[model samples]
Target: MALLVLVLSAIPRPAHAEIAAWMVFEVGSGEVIDQHEAFRRWYPASLTKLMTAYVAFSAIKQGRITLKSPVMVSAHAAAQPPSKMGLKAGSTLSLDAALKVMLVKSANDISVAVAETIGGSQAGFADVMNKTARELGMRDTHFVNPHGLPASNHYSSVHDMALLSRALLRDFPQYKRLYGYTGVQYGKRLLRSANREYLRRVRGANGLKTGYVCNSGYNVAVSATRGGRTMVAIVFGAASGLERAAKASALIEKGFDGGGVFKSHPKLDNLKRPGSVKGLPPDGYCRRNAKPKLEKLMADYAGSAPMRAANSGLPGVRTAFARESGRTRAAGIATSRADTTIPRTRDKKVDWGVVMDRLIGAQRRSDNLVRITLAIDPNAKRAVPLSAPSADDASKNVADAFGIVMPPRGKPDSRPATQPADTNTNAVPVIVTVPTRASDGTPTPRPAPR
Candidate 1:
């Protein structure tokens, strides 16, 4: 029996048997509230973008580049794989706009463009990333590329990522807004962020980044603030996006509720650990052959009731509609214009008048502006207007239509605000606009009414 037990113990177990790496750190006190397998090295994937952003911020601070600096796309950048901006070789955008595209869209091509622009070449940029990582005491981290594409030398630990997250918050506070954007309007295209959904669902959640690749699994470095206290959570090697988010949320919630305080937890910077180990490939746990193992992992990290309650809801329709209203105003569209832009079908243009009549009829029956808009042209950028109202008024109309209750100005909710019954009926209709394609298939905005 002893000989058999010794042989079994020496055999390798399935990846699911190992706990995923995770850590919760309190920003104010620098306390590591909790942690598991934090020192184990894992592929950073696009989490490498965080370091890329860091290097850019540092360059800006040192007067090497300005936000207005132009980042020109090169043939190399344009050739990068998907999760990219698809800009042509000679295309250029301001660094400010490029950063938004890279961070929120997680565009691999933009990452390389920014790298080449700032560091003279992709290889040089890798040096800068590594140097910065060392200065920040990211002991187990390495960078072989700016985009975190699969490379043998590209890896980091959850512990290192938490350290980097703290550095971002502490060093360049002004750029915090870059991490929280739900979506960025890049010309006629609106690029949305997966992190946006988490921001809407989590209470007090704000800025951070997320990453995924088959080798890394789903990874996220998320932070939330409540009552002046902030917590940062790092999760790695989850089987899916939902699991990754759920684990991060649970860790942050646990930190905020004094789970890390009662006991003596080590300060984040001072936590000692053994030497790093090679990260295990997540294929077994993340692929089709691992349903039972995935189920077990989910059960192990399943969130608490409070977390479930917090994340439960239709995504904030009020926020989405408000963003659309803001976009309309930015485009200088007139409130009095009755006509809305309609999308073109394969060979024919959609008739705006007929679409409006159908939408108005549907609105009368269902009061759902979104549903009505989708029925007309699912890809239309702006919401279908029933009547022209000021942006604020239009947003209120959308909120009422979606049964969402907007909080009074200057009063934000600590949790996802409980929406009450919709009572407003006089919803003003807003104009919707769709981009028209040029001869070369480039999208151009419809002109505002004179």
Candidate 2:
């Protein structure tokens, strides 16, 4: 018993499930390659901008707007928190420039500017977004804002994001260049892409987006093509940007290695959501106190010194790798003996501290801005009415306008049932455990019955 206990203690185990939800699917066939907790709703962060872009694309396709259309910033848009272009109210950029800045810089201001230009108001744009989500069969997603600044009731699943990514590639292949940009040049400043690191490190990586907020840890939607095979990987709630990139890289490699049209595996559209999976709450894993353990976990899982060495020169990344590599060596975990040569870059150095400070400060700034806006701007408060009529209510209203009597809500019909309940004794019974909700609204996982 002592010997068995000692062996078990020596075995490795993950400290935490750092990635809350993920999915990898083949673009050509829509075949699901691999997925984990794919259906559980989680914060979309800036990935919400993808949908915002999609709606804009649809409007352009319908001749309601054009790429050359001018998008002007408003006080409301300029008031948006950071990760922005810092454009002042009344400043205008062409729709094309707006898309480039929004996707590359993940600009909150540009997102709202585009929303206002195309949809008239932020709330109006949100209605269009929700409609587009339904049209695309993204049942688990709801968008309350365009820029994905933290908001209650805004959520998406990896499954839905993968679908959105695939849709963008399929519908607007011409815009593929937008996602792959390293940086976009505005009048005086060249704004770098948030996804530049992934594009540089991952082979065949091209387009997509990255997002972060206190509620949602680092999130990325990456699409890559190799040997004529394209794969899309969506990861939500990773502990850090580095870990998010590494996990995405791993999943993409796995997909290319073992993924294809598996006849038994369901297509992306047909893949069912796991009934009992619960959405993850914010873990605040990016906080200073949590870095050591998470960094060590990243080093162990990465298993490649070259990978770490190659990225060591990135702004704010070298220190993390330095500490993590030391611990990795002390633990005697063998890493690949491949080349440790650090790649050189001629691009200007980035001050990662300022970037991270802006991101971290956004939540507080946004909260304050919201309170101030609501107090001073009565129009903003009226923009999104809390008691606005739903689709069902609208339908009933239409019926009443035509003097038609609609059935009362939840009233059982007097008519006989058309179909009988299934009574087959030989059928296998599948049990699903429903997760309960905590007082804070986070889903609490329940144990399954035997």
Candidate 3:
């Protein structure tokens, strides 16, 4: 169950059960038409790569990185999950081919390769990501990796995603046509699009992204134009692909009703997830609370936030919200064409910011609401904080949220220097949960984002 884009027979419909969506019209014009769960904290999935692509493209436009830039494939990048171009170690690709594969197939490895080649390592590129998010004003978004892989801290909302869409269309019009692609051919393999049905159902449906994670559920960000008017539609927590498409269509049809982008209430707290934070990189500031965490700070200043569209009346949206909303957990999907269904678990409890970061690589971690579904199994049952034993990990982590009272790193030399005998200062190692293997116990190599 790779997160590959697949062919669909027909357009999708709204969920028969409870679900939500968010929509905006005339991006810079501040017009919104229809919406449901616009602000809901769903997985951005691969749609996050849009920003990754945008950043890379921007670098090229600015004469920083070029299309001919030869990015290398590190062992770490080569180890990424699948849907990839299958480059081996010592292999190199031009920025152009890498970007194309990323946008067309949503390749995860390629994304990392690009990040590493452009920004250095995954961590270094993350700094660039945070800065870009701040500049774009993605208020509810935080990126931990270049390729969106469903890390807890990597979460986003429709409102913030819409903003990125607008910026891409406006600021990066030179690459605007990249998103509207129906399909592309690579190495004798004709890669089709996951948006064919969407293109058919909507009048001016051009291009966009889709996403899904067990916790985040079915998410989508779409754009279309008609009658000299253009609009973007976003859906989160949908029951299925059918529902996602249907709701997007409804928003597009309803939105176009007003002659263009219209005005409707937006989910104000979309970025307001159950967490605290200091803004990401370059210009850091804290936005933590009771159970404050890095997420709060990172999300505090994301541009294109639901706050910008405070009047949008949509469900599942919030300026800040808990990990789970009061909706049912939709079925888990493996690709963009998976069947849709209403889920049962929608508990608004813990924060999922870090979880999202672990999912997508840092680059695509925006609140973009991707429409592609993934086989990334939800560790819902074992979903708990990873803490060190001796000193209360929860308490220490909790304190770190409030301020620098407890920095992320403690004095490594802090130990009981017994005068009687020789004592070692070696500390216990941090417990990092290992990623689950694919169903067949194989390492999944994800392709770049489509």
Best by TM-score: 2
Q: Which residue runs of candidate 2 sit more than 4 Å off their true CA positions?
A: 1-17, 259-264, 280-289, 292-299, 303-450
TM-score on alpha carbons, each prediction: 0.63, 0.64, 0.56
Q: Which stretches of candidate 1 lie over 4 Å from their true place?
A: 1-19, 275-450
Q: What is the TM-score of candidate 3?
A: 0.56
Q: What CA RMSD would candidate 2 show?
A: 16.8
How does model 1 score by TM-score?
0.63
lDDT of 2 by residue, 299-409 (tens): 444434223333333554422222222132222322454212221223444333222211111011110000001012212111212123355543442343233556556
How well does model 2 score by local distance difference test?
0.68
User: What tens digits encode model 3's per-residue C-alpha lDDT throughout 107-172?
Assistant: 788898787666655666777887898888887788888877867788677777887888888887
Question: Candidate 1's residue-wise lDDT over 294-365, tens digit each?
Answer: 334334443242323332343442111111211322222223222233423445655332232212110111
Q: In order, what lDDT does every prediction score?
A: 0.67, 0.68, 0.55
TM-score of 2: 0.64
Q: Model 3: how far is 286 from its true place, Å?
A: 32
